[model samples]
Target: MDEFEKIQKLIRLKKYETPGEQFVDEFVTAFRERQRAEMLKQPALSLLWESFRAWYDQLFSPRWTLAAAVVVIGFICGFAFMPRGGQTHLARRGKAPDHPAMTLSLGKDQTGKTLPAFSIETIRVMGEIEIEPDPGLLSKHFTGGYDQIVIVPHDEADTAIAVPYDFIHLDGKPDIR
Candidate 1:
């Protein structure tokens, strides 16, 4: 017989082959039994991990995603807004700090020229300062909201010229460039 004819005969014979009726009926029962056996042998940690993984997968599932996200967000907001010990966050922030913001103690050096003394204590929230443009519908004398940058002289304040990020020389002539 030629290759094509031999292949056709083999396929025709294969069509008759099928699993017995008993296998189909017992498949679900057999699968459940195997799963139960596997679970029984699994360690506590493994079982906990599997449960957590399954729960995490379910939380992000399409049908439950919106509800789960809302619940998570609500919990976060609740914790953030809730007072700790005896003080609310806004209440604490509003209260005036115990220490002075800035203090300058003057002392004359050996040369008797007043030694430039400056102590500045500052806490800054790192963020981009947003300056919204003024439309100037009802314009004042000054174009901007603020009048000008007032620079106190060296004698009035311990002023010195330094680099852009002025860590050393705090009080100095303003860089207008």
Candidate 2:
């Protein structure tokens, strides 16, 4: 077609798709309304994910990028220098404890098959070992002559002296009884 005819055809197509006076405003309003409705109707997990995405996007924004970086670096350095639980008390001071204080004995069931257990060992707490404490409660659990057991008063063991409770990942059947 000639240039004029081509222009006419293009204009005819554009006429049907012309931007309405409130096109931007209407679109924005509908978008915001849909977002609000979706947020209201979304399940908890979806809301959490959306919130996380928003926070993550905010973290990358110019206003928050530097603050987020500083916070991240601070966390990294803090964790890097922190004392880990596996490091023995003596080992932290450049000396390894003699005869590993605590050792794990993989337990076997009465059928002599490996099963689950918290830990079976001489749990070394800060005190002397008592071989069969209190003759009255001595033969309480086992019958084959009580082996040595360590007992610590609650007041002593419950102290807040930097115990690595969270780091105790050694899996064994918890001594529930």
Candidate 3:
């Protein structure tokens, strides 16, 4: 009538039967044999490789093998039959070919005679470009027309000479000669 009583009644009615000892022994032996067989079987990778080899062998039968062989033979024959000779036309200039031709000779120390990448004057101009002129100096030297001016540093003394109306400003203007 109660839950516990019902459970007890069910437990009593239920057959708690187990297999015979011989049957249990035979089942465990069969299970162990199955496990041993599984352990002895090839790994998945080896099985997959063997299957791939079989598939490849089936795919490339006698016909495919003959076609591949023919392709290789054709390539070999093509290379063997290729023409070998001087393809360039030569001009017979009566003069014998000279070793180390005079035309190929270069002037000695050509770089020494060449002009520098930037002259001293060019460097001076660049130096002037970087200098921010004194606002008082700018007010005195620069007028409304010229926004920029170049200050020349005279080597005679350590004095920097502000060239009036000669400096280059950010505003577009022709070079003051």
Winner by lDDT: 2
TM-score of each: 0.39, 0.29, 0.23
Question: Which digits, one per residue and each the tens of the lDDT, describe model 2 over residues 38-157?
Answer: 888999998899889998887688667888889999989976875443333343344332332222233455698864323232222232221112223323322223233322223543
- C-alpha lDDT of candidate 2 relative to the true structure: 0.48
Candidate 3 lDDT for residue 115: 26
Worst 10 residues of 2 by lDDT: 124-133
Count of steric clashes across candidates, in order: 0, 4, 5
Cα deviation of 20, candidate 3, in Å: 1.7
Query: Candidate 3 on 48-159: residue-level lDDT in tens?
Result: 8988999989999989989999999998997677433211112212334222211111112445563211101111123322222333444343232122332323456435
Whole-model lDDT values for every prediction: 0.48, 0.48, 0.45
What is the descending TM-score order?
1, 2, 3
Cα lDDT of model 1 by residue, 139-166, tens digit = 2211222222122223434244321222
Q: How far is candidate 3 from the true structure (C-alpha RMSD, Å)?
A: 27.2
Model 1 collision count:
0
Candidate 3's displacement at residue 18, Å, is: 1.9
